[model samples]
Target: MLFTTPTFAEEKAAEKTEQYDPKGPILEHIADSHYWHMFGEHSLPLPVILYTNKGIEVFSSHVFEHGKEEYQGNYKYALIKDKIKPVTEAGEIDTTVRVWDFSITRNVASMWMGMAILLIIFLSVKGKYKTRAGKAPKGLQSFMEPLVLFVRDEVAIPNIGHKYKKYMPLLLTMFFFILISNLLGLIPFFPGGFNLTGNIAVTIVLATITLITVNFSGNKNYWKHIFLPHIPVWLYPIMIPVEIIGIISKPFALMIRLFANITAGHIIVLSLISLIFIFNSLWMSPVSVLFVVFMDTIELLVAFLQAFIFTMLTALFIGMAVEEHHAEAH
Candidate 1:
């Protein structure tokens, strides 16, 4: 009985010790860790791993300091322990259970969101077509019909010509898919949080498609102009190479512009929120949250703006590539 008197207090102390106790400063919750510390010392080559239960982690190829020297290797499951860990000499631990090197990680939650968006748009259009076959559109159709017609009349037809109606499907699909994904990324909650368009790899892939389409769709005149534009004979030597370089540079510029702009927007918003943690004050958090939310609202418009800009530029490039110039006899 005397020994049992102290047992309850000891058990309570043990329970407290076993509970999760963070030993260091808490991290600011950024939208996605993909672009965090993008150019800083701890910048990662891959996106950081986020676990529902375990929190943030990284698979780093870090150098571990041995007693005398350092060695480099993959630290597959390095748990992000504390605010910062000393560059361990024994090599970082690989704690990553699954790797997501691709820009789009197909998690259960993301897949459902993607599927939901797809279904909603498809059903909306299907229902509209069912009710109004040839009659004037109403409701969802009213809003979407103009955008569809605009892309066809203003973008595809004008750029690609009468013989190129077949290509409209791909162009329209690309435009809408990008626009939808960009808009979905603006939502803060569970169903629409993924930054599909902001991923650099996705932008690169889109640019590659545009590059391929432009070159493949080019007529003999297009290639001739690239290799030997109608310049003075003496100037051909200098100008030919420049023209070729320009052709290559166009798509490269598109890739970089989209990637940089999207990534920068996300980073700015994240940095604004991180300001609270930097100051370590509850008072600072409210101001930081307000500013970040305002920027996020602006980003909603930017998402559509970027999609429109990309599509417009793509149409312009196609127009230039497919144009037929008539020259009078000189």
Candidate 2:
């Protein structure tokens, strides 16, 4: 039989005078003590969980538990205060979310960075256009004009053919958006701090857009080649399935490649910095910082490389779909 014991009157009085001290090593470790505002050595990978008093919480599994005792099975939350906390029923929190989660997230921070970069490029080109007084372009315009012409001449013209002008706007917009967003991800400060390109949702959306465009833009010849190829009759059945799967898989590959590469770079950089804290060695601090800085530099190049690769592959795929193969004369 289970018995619930009630405190004696004398024991209750003694307990009140003694005071119930909540402070302990476990509490100290779990408490939000560190000042994130101060840019210094004290940084901990505290697991941040979002919760509402109304019974909803979102958080990473990694930092939620401190030890075996702290493990609450699915009950991950540790009560910080008894008071009810107000939170959105669904959607992003503008405040109180952990910085790492914020950094990894795709949000307004990333959107603004992408917009700002595009604005700068367009304004600079426009400025040059005005100064030239209807003459040949110079400076920024000179640099950008060739790229614009190259996309028209090399990418759009060759792939989309004589009717390429119709699709030029979409192609150009996609290329520049991907390029600028990728580049912005490499920046470690304010506008660039958020890893927009690293997020799978963003990549998937972009890939889906490309997939839709490629299939929708296909000509009659494109569909004929995919459904009923010019190959052997016996091979058509097997080849048809493979070819259709390949068509779907290409854009999926694009989504994974971009997302993995960007996310991996950031994780690596963070891991390097985390080493110093893990070791708790003063000597290791400088080395870790230097290594992280070096990695950040490499990421800058990777940003541009990924953007170019994605754009080039897209052009290649479009080229394949639209390329006209004439029947050989007997």
Candidate 3:
């Protein structure tokens, strides 16, 4: 079941006393974990892969029983704060031993699923183009054609100029990946609501790719403007540092903007629903449900808006780097 009611004796008793705490559940929903939580007490356990001082350790996350028990492998390991780490014989966190986790967490799994979805979609769209050549776009091609053209015409050409074709793949990938992931997150079901884009680690990676692309694509004029601006030579020392900071800051803004917007949307929706349990009144459900629907409508628009904004800014930054001066053109 996607959602459950208080049916068990203990759960009913807790409801009677109204000891509900929304913090833990809310945080867990927005954060990545070793297992994919479905609803209620049901979850799909994932593999726990760890590199420790003793060597590699692999086990099912189920062994920890959602962190209620400690698992003894190459060395004792415990799931603390949703992370698997080495623990002492006494069950204390063993700080002496170094551990590196390469496990496929919920977010990683969600990313793979999202990637698979994108592959199926674009591949189908690609095949249709050849088979349906010279014909008006129909079916999926008709659906996706406008979006593809939107990125090219509305976003890329306006920002990156004639060189936009080279970066179309990157910009298209960014837009669809983020858009699909955000849409999936709003679903309150097993395969969805994984919070992939809302995670900081994911945003950092997306932003870093943009940063690398922007810098690598920088033209001779781009570097010249940064290192040898039209400023007085005396101000070079100050402007040089500022120019370098600008390069880093652009991507940093992209990272924070996506992470904060998606995360805040989830938090707000969850917080609104939390009011029902907080007040312990069925009367509040109607009001809460109304607000949730309204916010969800807004979130749907935001899902598309954020993806567009991120792609737009990335193209804008690339445009800044690859643009030529009028003097050079002459």
Candidate number achieving the greatest TM-score relative to the actual structure: 3
Give the number of the best model, judged by lDDT. 3
Ranking by lDDT: 3, 2, 1
Q: Which digits, one per residue and each the tens of the lDDT, describe model 3 over residues 156-229?
A: 99999999999999999999999999998888778886788899999999999999999999999999988988
Assess candidate 2 and give its TM-score to the true structure. Answer: 0.63
**lDDT assessment of candidate 3:** 0.87
How do all models score by TM-score? 0.65, 0.63, 0.94
Question: Candidate 2: misplaced stretches above 4 Å?
Answer: 1-106, 130-136, 157-163, 327-330
Name the candidate, 2 or 3, with the larger TM-score value. 3
Under the 3 Å rule for N, CA and C atoms, how many clashes does model 2 have? Answer: 0
Candidate 2 differs from the real structure by a C-alpha RMSD in angstroms, to one decimal, of 13.7
Query: On residues 1-330, what C-alpha lDDT tens digit does candidate 2 reach at each position?
Result: 000011112233344456422223112211122111112222222333444333444443233222211223223233222111222333223245322222212233456658777879878898878778789988778877886787788778876677677667767776678778777656554334455677777789888887887888677777888787878899988999988998889999999998888877876775665455445466988998899889878888888677766666677677666667577221
Better of 1 and 3 by lDDT: 3
C-alpha RMSD of each candidate structure in angstroms: 12.2, 13.7, 2.8
Error of 3 at 144 (Å): 1.0
Can you write out model 1's per-residue Cα lDDT over 161-242, one digit (the tens) per residue? 7745766766776677677776665554434545566666667888888888787777777777877677788988898888
Q: What is the alpha-carbon lDDT of model 2 when measured against the actual structure?
A: 0.58
